[model samples]
Target chain A: MIPIILFLAPALAMALFIFRSKKLNAVVICLYSFTHLACSVTLLVHPASYGRYFQVEPLNLFFLVVLSVVLAGISVYNADFTLKSAVPARKSTYYSAAVLVFSAAISGVVLGANLGMMWVCLETTTITGAYLIYYKTGKEPLEAAWKYMFICSIGIAFAFVGLIFLSLAFTGSQPSLFFTDINAHAPVFNKFWLKMSFVFMAIGFGTKAGLAPVHTWLPDAYSEAPSPVSALLSAALLNSELLIIIRILKIMKIADLGGFASAFLITMGVLSVFVAAVYIIRVGNYKRMLAYSSIENMGLITISAAIGGPAAFAAVLHIAAHAFSKASLFMTSGNILKRYYTREINGVTGLLKADPKAGWSWIAGFILLCGIPPSPIFLSEFIMIRTMFGRGMWWLAVPVMLLVTIVIYGMASTMFKMSFGNPQKGISQERFNILNYAGQFVFIAVLCLLGIYMPKAISDLITAAASLM
Target chain B: MTEVLIAIFGITMLYVSSTSRVEAYIRVLAVQGVILFLMVLLDHAHLEVLNLVFLGAETLLFKAIIIPVFLMFTVRKNNIQREAEPFMPSFYSVLITTAIFAFGFLIAFWASSNASNVRPLYFGVSIATIITGLFIIISRKKIITHVMGYIMIENGIFMLAMSVVGEMPMIVNLGVLLDLFAAIYLLGLFVTKINSTFDELHIDSLTNLRD
Candidate 1:
């Protein structure tokens, strides 16, 4: 029943959109989002109702749940955002419908039992995401949308070729692309083809994951996109891309190619963080700053997850912590953008004095993002650092800590300057709307709660999900 | 017959590499599409009726007919100048493309040494075509030409997928076709949108959002 609703709801939304029943869209969005979250929570106990094409196992269970949670928050936020924004009626309807499609596609990417199905779902996310990125349709948005569309599509297309190469590793007439089956028989697959396949996919899926070398489209898309879309892309879409890469890396693990995959992963991971570190300081726009931070966090996740053991557990915690915090920050940045009409760091001033809720949320989000104490990111980073030492990876620890420090300092200095200054003349205080800050506050509260006291069940789930590596 | 179709398919990349005219590129894409449909049909002569229909729709209807027509419409509608205005000289592009093709054959020779279910010629040609498609993208300046490069890469990838005898599930095949269609369709839409928004349809105009 859950899977049915999950799959059918998008089509229903599209139908409604086509019929011009754009009213009640906010309620429709909220109802469908609850169904999505409920379905993910339900799948924690029961396997998916649709088992052939989509499956739910421990590896994907937590990812699915996090996606739903982040998306649910985004959905609530988007409902408020759409209702209040001065966007024309038809445009808002299209936005709502596109969001539904994007939701389904990301869900599909998480639940795909077959590798090919995952590839398809991953590409669909790009198409829908481009729409959201291009929502404003101005010069910057158009350019961002174009680059995002071209690069990611070409990346996924190469991934499809990689899929074919993976099939070539098998000698049979019909190669099974089932994820579990591939993982099981990975040892027997041809090493040459498997290595080739991984190279293509690393470049391919890495583009989506915001890894260095292929991460150029990310900052543009993130900054140009409406805040909610940025939230969704950072929180949900990236995790889905990482899920597939994690599965592929598992194949490498089973095939005795763990070192190769890990070396490749760490290189990209380090480079991503290094790149983000360099750019975060030099970048002028605050939203692009958030985008670079996402790249850095993704780098951190990949590095620790590659290291395995307790660090992998920490990585999962980091994924959740980063998702909600980044979502909060980006959306709050939207609030900041609306208040000031500028994304430039120097252009806007006195955020705290003007709108206290958004201002505080912005600072809290920055705190969580930079891994301050009492934020779950602090706990995750602590575990990663401990594992780095215990495993005799003291060399990796230096760069990791250094780049992390750079990132925090860069973001913190910008955040403080924006938060503390006096407002420019002609600034008017808009009516306080709880919806704008509601999702962000809730996420911050959850992260704080997790940091102070991690629940046993949630810990168990993260542990189990981490063990799949 | 299969080798001949594949040979003509590989040769199409040579023309695309050497040509600067957008109309010629569109025609060559159409030719490659027909050749792909023929090659796939020949490879899987004993396929089921359902599979045959899908292959025909994906390769013949969409790839050959619809996509070419759409590209043509975009070209005419945008009033784009005929020259693709590639970043490199045509002579250099032809040389590089040929070298890449030679490299592909060398790889095929090496890969054939292993025990695998691959058609060496088909595999080699498709790899070269894919590389050449990428080369076209990097060496070209026009956004429309970039879309052509994307379409070429798709064709090359499709051919590569078909080169091996292994069968992906029909559902995945459907997914691939649908995605390809949506991507190209969206590319067409954006080409028109970008064309109107900017003075020239060149990639240089797209540098506004860079960090």
Candidate 2:
């Protein structure tokens, strides 16, 4: 029942947009967000009651919570942001509808019990998100939207091929697409087909996860999109894609092919970090830099998952922490963009003087993202490094740490320069509504609070989700 | 009979690689769709009425009719140039595609010798088609050509899926069909948008957002 409502609320909101009332659009979006959050909480509390097709397991519960929190925050921010933006009414309605649809698609991805259903939901996100990226109605945004749609479509098409290969692994059996059934039957499956399937799935979903080699579209799409949409792309969409990859890893584990899969993940993970380091150091666009940072963090998560055991637990924690921190950072970047009217790093200075709240939030979010003290990413990175050393892979740890340090320095230098300098003379100093800052505040508060204290229930949930992987 | 049809399907990709015209690409796609429809009919004699109907609609209507016609509509609407302007010359593309086809045959022969459960010819042609499609995408400069290449890839995947026809659930088939239609629809729409936004439909113009 909850799952049904969760799926329907966004559809209802999208339908409401046809009436073209901006006020109603805001009302419906907020209503949908609160309802979604409520459903996530209820589902988290009683995950077993859901139907088989959309069951809320511990792993999905954590993702659902993260998504719901981010959605709630974004919705609040969007209400204020949309009101002030110069977009026409019709486009705003479309934007509002697309946002709802995007959220619903992500929720569907998290809640989907079958791989096929998850794939469908994931593709839906690409479509809806393409619209959001194209919201600015410019040549560049159009290119971003086109590349995003076309490349992701190709990537996902390959993933579908991967799914076909996966089915081929079930030779002479009652073929099933359900995750539980696949896991149960994995050991007896054809190893060659399974390996082939994993390769395709990795490339296919890896494109969406913004893994290196297939991550060409990520920076462009992120930089070109509206900030809130960027937040959703980095925070929720990437996590959902990773969730599929994690499920594949679980199947690999059951088939005694965990080592093989882990090797590939680690290779891609290291490559992603290396790629992020290369680009982050010289990136001209701040949003593109944030996009690169996302790639780096995703790489770390992949590396953590590859290390398995305690590192897997850290991977889950890092996912949650990164979501909040990155969302806040992206939202704050929105504030910066609003004030400065430019995405170029060189264009803005004295952020602290121009807008103290956004400036501080930017610094805080960057620090949190950089894995400074108490940030869950710091703990996650520590555990991952320990795992590497424990496994006698100190060689791998050295480059990873080096690359991470480079990325940190690159991001921090730019951030500090932007945050503390004298304001550029001609830029207008318009005050933003408090509501615009509300989401970032919530995200930062959560990130900071979690860094210092982990409530027992949240810790238990993270542990349970990790153990599943 | 199915083998001959599959071979023809594989040969279509060669023609596609050698050609530089957008209309030729669409024609190739339509021909492949028809061949696929025939292959399905010949291979799945035991399929239920509903399944047969679904396959017929998928192959004949959507793939052969709707997609090509819709693409042609987009092409006409945009008044796109006739020449595709490949990154590489036609001769090289043809030579490379031939080499790929030979490689596919080699793979098929090897897998047949190894007693693999997969039908070697199906695996070989599908893999070659997929590779050729990717090559087309990479070598082509125009967005429409890229889309055509993507369709080729979809056709290859469909061929592979046909190899294990009854084993997969119906829902997977439905999902695949949905994805295909949606992807094609969206790609076509974007082509029009790109036409209007940029002076030309060349993909090089899309480099504005890069770092």
Candidate 3:
């Protein structure tokens, strides 16, 4: 019953938007967000119920909570952001509808018990997200949307090929693609087909997760998308894609193929950090810089999962923390864009004087992103490094630490320049609605609170989620 | 009979690789759809009536009729050039695609010798088609060509799925068909938007949003 409502809330919102009532857009969105958050929380407390195609497990519950929280934040920010922006009423309604569908699709991805259903849901997110990215259609946004749709569709098609290969891995009986059924039969599965499936799934879903080599569309889409939508893309969407990878990794572990899966993850992780470092140093657009930062964090999460044990625990924590902090950073960046009207880093300066609320938020968000002390990322990275030492992976730790340091330096230096300087001409001085800061403050407060002390119940939830991984 | 259809499907990929006209690509896609439809009909003997009807609609109506007509409409409405304008020459593209086909046959041969469950011809031709589709995307400069490449990949996947048709549930098959239709429709919409915004459909014009 709860699951049906969870899915229906957004579907109902999308249906309402078809009527094109501009005034009710915000109300419908807010109502859906609250309902989603409440449903996620209820499921978290009592997760026994099941749907035919979807289920609420520990790992999915954690992800659902993170998605709902970030989505709720985005909704709050969207309420004010929409009224102030120049989007026409019809487009705004369309944007709201797309966002609702996007959320519903991702919710489906996380909750789906069947791999094929997950693939379908993930593909739906791509289509809906492209719509959201093209919300304010122009040359740049349209290009970003095109690349996002085309590249991701091709990648996901490869994943479907991988699913076929996965089906091929089974013998003596027809294979079922339900998660539990696959896990039960994984030991007898053909290793060759399994490896092939993993590679295809990695590249396919990796494109969606913004991992390296296939991560080109990410920065473009992130930079061109409206700020609230960017927040969702960076904060929520990438994690949903990673959840699929983690699910596959579990099957690999059960098949005694954990080493093979870990090796691929470690390689992609290191490569992503290296890629992020290279782009971060020479980045021209601040929004693009944040996109690269997201790549770096996702890479770290992959590394943490690859390292296993306590590191997996840290990885789940980092996902939650990064969701809040990154969403905050993106929301604040939207505020900066609203003031400066340019994504170019050098185009605007003296953010401190221009808008102190956005500036401080930007600085705090960057610090949190860089894994500074009191940011949950700091603890996650620290645990991952310790796991490396305990596992005698000194060779891996050295490069990982070095690349992380380079990324930190690159982002901090760039952020410092943007946050503290003389106010440039042509910057808008309009009074921002206090609601604009409301979401960022909530995200920041959550990050700081988690870093300082995690409640016992939440810690238990994180531990249970990690154990499943 | 199934092998003959699969062989014909494989041959159409070569035609796709060697063609410069967008219309030729669409025609080949329609042919591939028809071949796939025949293959499905030949292979499945005891499928329920509903599943057969669904598969028929997906392959015949959506893949063969709806998609090609949609692409033709898009090409006409956008006034895109008739030529695909690939980065590589057609002869070289054909050469590479043939090489991929041979390589796929080699893999199929090796797999069949070692495993009884593997369907060598289906695996070989489908993989060859997929690789050729990716090659088309990489070697082409036009956005419309890329869409065609994507469609070719989808067709390849459909062939692969058909190789083990009885194993996958009806829901999964329907989901895959629905996703393919949605992806192609959305891609067509984007191509039209790109044509209007950039006033050109070339992939090179899309470099404005880069880092």
Candidate 4:
């Protein structure tokens, strides 16, 4: 029942976006975010089901909380981000509406108990997200939106084929599309079709998760979108995609094909990390650099998920930790973009002199992303490597660690070049809004506190989520 | 009867690949939707009246009527160039699609040899159509043609779902159809905007965003 409000909140907001004056755009967005945060918290505290099609299980519970938290932060930032913009009022109005729909689609993806429902919501994200990317109405945004939507649509089509294959595995009276039903009966399913289904779904859902080879659109789309949207894309959208994969992985485990699923995920994970390591070095666009870092983080989480057990605990923690850390970085990047008016790494320097607050946030975001101590990423990477060694996956562990180190440098060099230099002459000296920093400040603080100490409730939630995986 | 309709559905992709005219692709989609409607009607004859009506509305009104109409409207409104300007020649495209069809046939025969539950023909044709749709998307230079390829893949998915012995709920089917409509409408809107922005549906002008 509470899940219905998550869906309804967006509808209400969309109504306000259409009927009300533009002034209410921020208020409507803020209201919806509050509604979103409220519903997810209630749902987590008191698990509820919306018929058989939507349920708040341990796995999605963790992802839902992460998404709501990220949305809450992005909403606050977006309210200010829209206040003064090069973007016209009409365009920003549509942008606000699209963001609402995008967040709702993601929540739908996370809440769906039925795989079909999840797939629908997943595709909805592609549509809404494409519009959000194209909000500025120009060449680059169009191209980015086109590539993102077209590629993801095809990926989604393949996933539907996978769903068909899943039905093929059931030879009896009726095939079920519900996740729990599939999980319950997977042991008796046909092995050949099960493997085939897994293959197609991995490629299908993996594409959306920005897993490598199929991840060609991630950099462009992430780099091209406005910073608030980028934060949502990096923090919320990708998690929903990975959550689907996690659900599929659980099904694979139930069928005693955990070995196959684990190998497949690890291979994809390393490829994603390697792609980041290769591409991040050559990127001149700071936003694209951040985009590559996102891919690498996603790869790390995937590897941890594949490793299972306590490593899966690390995976869940890293997902939450990375969500906050990355969102803050992207939001801070917005601040830098507004002042400098360029995305190129060489376009602006002396970020510290220009806006010390943003500059420090950027540095702090880099440190958190690089997995230094007091960042949960450090703990996750440590556990991931120790577990890989414990499992005698030396070959996998060593290369992933090396590639990740390279990725860290790729981001760090870009960060230092921008953060420490003199603020470029002739930069815009527009009055900076304190509200612009609201989201990033809260995100950084929460991330730092979590890194220092994990509350029992959150850790228990993480453990429960991991056990399901 | 359904098998015959399914085979015709697979053959439609061959036409899709062989043609240079984008309108023909849209026409083929309309034909495939009609084919799908017929197949669903024949298959679900015994379903409840409510389910039957909804399914009919889905494949007929939504799939057959709405999509192709909007697509044709988009093409005409944009005055898009009729030529698909595919990356490869039509000859190679035809050959590749044929090869894909043969492979699908082979897989259908091989996998279902021991299983009575397999509807080999539908499985083969749907798989073949899906791959061919993907081929069209990658090979074609026009964004409109790419959309046609997407719709083609969607038709293949509908056929694939129909092939299964047990049925997915009508609600899921309705959801897919609705989502497909939304996707097409948005894509069409973008295509129009893209046409105006770059002055054509050419993919070449979209090269600015690369790393």
Candidate 5:
């Protein structure tokens, strides 16, 4: 089955990482990404061959495509990122292994028909990411890694406990925990236990997804990780966690508990946006600021998912747009970090003058991130707001619109401060690798095109995916 | 027979909490593994024979023997005898752990009204043990003791699962057990690294990043 490749490509890549040269690892990752991308496209066009445990539903197919594309982009960028590494030998193996492991894990989460299997993959991703987060091996990275493990491990443990509670809700026949079986029989589950399970799962997985109130680990982990890892964490890893929550959301829909589940999600979603917006304005680290921005976007998706109906459409679109834009932004941030040799907001200036490619990418990324015109994120945000207003939930739209505005202002201010000002004297002129520039260019180009238009096949996939939800 | 094994499981945590010696904590984990293996054999009469054998061997080999061997290696490698610098005083930790155990017992008793569905005693003692394990994790300062606390929590979870879902598939059980062991091994290795890096096992030193 194609799903086997989806899982194995990464595992094999990890093994190869241990033995192969750095150049070989890069080629392998690129090959895996291409293979993964090709399989996802084929799966989207013809769904018959897809296995039950690893079917490519339209929504997941969209995510698969985004994941593969971003990974491929990161792979190319990684070729250069590795060169800039002050400590290459010790760090490269871990980085490659993480990519391969994270890819397999993400694909597994996206495609898994069994909840228990998906949980395993999600937990596996968390463990694999530990190396990536601790790559720097500095005081900050170590601290970040510890918090990342402890918090995520506990959160995932809670998710397992939720799985047990969900299993407890079954009454007749052998109690099944597979997603397909659970969905089919969800309507008959004991309401009390089902709701309790949902609460626990939402909080548990939400922590991994970087949803607010439980998102304390995100800023530290994302800020401290190497840029490419930050990109993966923000763009790909979080989506898999979201996929887990979406699986439960599907169950809620099947059980006709949408009303209850939606209420809970809306509360968390709005809180995430408000908290992120407040934090974004004054973040000291540029990477942490972007991390906060990611939290806000994820919050938007959550709120949109809670709205259901057409809003699910918006949620899917926003997820895609956010993936591309945020990946581009984080990758470009890596460029800035390499050039400036510092992540502090005050340490670097005149980004445009120093390196136009990285600087413009930063600006363009911010524009896309803030939902500026012609960007897919803007289109998605528009649709989400319209969906809310059309449903006569004008009150719900208020905080979303207000928080987004504040976020826009905050991001704009940060970009302005970092981009246009005079370059600090005595700043060393660093050589930007051609491979890095090409990767960023490819990423930004893809993002721009996706914003302006989506290919019909992908759009159809998105529509079908939304209908399933 | 399972009841006796499960009771020993609960008592092990009390011993783990009251002790300052990290080596004793590792020993208690080995004893708990033996207790769990016996408990599984005595209680899971509904499980397939092959699964029971597999579970029995796994608990005996990995849980009882292999993991404890690794922890002992880590113990010897680090040369850490006692985690004498607990975050809280021993007396306070003991009192807090006792209170948590009592609260867990109350929860189990209150929730286990369906007598035929699950055993009240199994639920009560397992919950108490889990809470006490968590108490150890919180009150201990050393990473080694933290790992022991994690193992204790895992054991308590395994007992709870055995009590409630006696007929879990072999694959699920194996995966759960393997994952927990891997987590403990990784955490233990990290503790050693932390010890070597900083020359102290105190978790407080890992607090450099903040808003």
Candidate 6:
């Protein structure tokens, strides 16, 4: 009961409070984050206590931890992030509500046992996140928000259509759409409809997951959205969508649709890598570049999931690591935007010279994002490569390696270019931005520490979650 | 009997292709919407009363009345009325639509033998309508006309859903309604925004972000 309330309270409070006082959204988001983190910890310690509507399964428990930690970091940064905009009153009133709703919707998506319920939660994420995307109502943001809404709405609609088809596939003594029920009887379902449904589901949820071909909306959306929301979009929101795919992948295995589905996923996943590789090179906007990098990481995870076996474990671990590292990177980028007043790669230089705190965080973030050593992304990528080779798909591993290398050079060159050259004239020095700088450091430190030493508990949780999938 | 109405609905696309006036397109939407309402009523009369009521109210309120009325209001508000110029000549457009419509029927007919349980008439017409909507969206320059194109595609999807399943979870139905309504509202709002921001709502002007 408490866990259910923990999930519901944020959205409810956000709705009730935002109607009256918008500035309270940040405080409400913080309260929800703290309470959620506390509740998830409690639920983790006593698995029997979380009730039926909600449970902290080892898989979702790991996601819950990632979500809470990232939310806390975003909440702290938003405390100051929201103030920088001119409409302080509106910012305060609306920011927390948006965050709370987004947080609740994402948590619900991860924990949902029923597919219909998951779809509703995913839709809610879109409707609420649209407001955040359009925070300033600038032309570019509006364009991005429009694309996000229409594309996602269409994609989700296709997902629903797939669900209906999946229901049709369950032609047996008793048909059910519940995940548990489907898993129980997946062996006997019609192969054709199941294959068709998986295709639709993969593309539908994959669009939301920021997988390639259907990923045209990500760079526009993530780059234009306010920084904290981008963090949530890349970190928590993408994970929830991946959770749905993971669920479907499990079903495919049980149904013996494994080979076909894995081929499809690998094909799309590699296409995403290639697309991200091409686009990340010429992107002059730093924020857009980061958004494209997210596309690349998501593709890597998809391919890893296709490889399965121990690599599935690596995929889940990569999710956790990427969530932290990307959130930290985007937040630090926000700090840079504050000092430099530009997101253009060429506009601001000498970040170590101008603001060392943000500059070094930026560089370190690039290192982790590029899968360099000591970062958990590096560890996860290495394991995935090993999985590919062991599976005798040496050619597949080459593209994955090549794409990663290209993206690394792409991001490193951009960051190095932006962070080292002489400070361009007319850049303002921001003194009151100390807390934002502090928030970035704390987030980066968490990622770096986790990379250096994975605690026994977290590793246990990852292994357990991988087995369940 | 249902097949006849479905055919009329498909033929309306041909009529739509031959027209230069935006008013005629709206009229096509009005006719299409009513036809969809009737088709739903005929097909689902054997369903549970609660389901029938829900379906009836959805078609009557949203499809037939609300959406068309809303589009009409937006049309009136954006007054340079008739869309006289089209990218392709009307004769060629009609010929192309006819070919597409025939192709849609062929595919649906081919598929029906495989999926013998569902209504092929519904499948064929809906696919043709969806194609026509795409055709109009591509050929028309006016934003209002494009909105019309979107509605036609949405109507096709609705008809297809009804014909195949004949029943949907009420929650999904509600969601579908909410999404469509919100889409129109947002698109309408953007149309207004575009009109004021730039001198007109030409989509070509939104190309400022290109490489």
| Residue-level lDDT tens digits of model 2 in A1-469 | 4555456766776587679867777777888888888888887777654566677789988988888898898888788877777777788888888888888899888887889889988888998899899988789899888888888988998898788888888866877789989998999888878988899999999999999989989999999999989998999999999999999999999999999999999999999999999999999999999999999999999999988999989999999998889998889888899889899999989999999999999999998999998787888899899999998999999999999999999999899989986998887778788987999888888887888998899999999999999
Model 3 interface CAPRI class: medium
Per-candidate DockQ versus the true complex? 0.58, 0.62, 0.64, 0.53, 0.34, 0.29
Range of the 10 consecutive residues with the lowest summed lDDT in candidate 4 chain A: A1-10
Question: Between the candidate structures 2 and 3, which one is better when assessed by DockQ?
Answer: 3
Runs of candidate 1 with Cα error greater than 4 angstroms are A18-23, A47-49, B169-172
Off by over 4 Å in 4: A86-91, B169-176
Alpha carbon lDDT at A4, candidate 6: 55
Error of 3 at A415 (Å): 0.7
In candidate 6, which residue pairs clash? A22-A92, A22-A93, A23-A92, A23-A93, A25-A96
What TM-score, computed on C-alpha atoms, does each candidate reach? 0.96, 0.97, 0.97, 0.95, 0.92, 0.92
Docking class of 1: medium
Output the better candidate (3/5) by TM-score.
3
Q: Per-residue lDDT for A126-243 in model 1, tens only?
A: 8889899999987889999889988998888778778877887865435778986787778888888888889898889989999997899999999999999999999999998888
Question: In model 3 chain A, which range of ten residues has the least summed lDDT?
Answer: A1-10
Q: Which is superior by TM-score, 2 or 4?
A: 2
Worst 10 residues of 1 chain A by lDDT: A15-24
Expressed between 0 and 1, the share of native interface contacts present in candidate 6 is: 0.00
Q: Which window of ten consecutive residues has the lowest lDDT sum in model 6 chain B?
A: B166-175
Candidate 5 stretches greater than 4 Å from native: A7-11, A14-19, A48-51, A83-91, A389-395, A454-456, B14-24, B72-76, B79-81, B84-86, B89-95, B102-116, B127-132, B171-175
Model 4 vs. true fold: TM: 0.95
Clashing pairs in 1: none
> What is the DockQ (computed on Cα atoms) for candidate 3?
0.64
State in Å the error of residue A216, model 6. 1.2
Which wins on lDDT, candidate 4 or candidate 6?
Answer: 4
Compose the digit string of candidate 5's lDDT tens values, residues A21-117. Answer: 6666666777777777777677666764345666666667777777777777777777766655656654576677677887888888877777877
- Best DockQ among the predictions, by candidate number: 3
The TM-score obtained for chain B by all candidates, in the order given, is: 0.93, 0.92, 0.94, 0.91, 0.88, 0.89
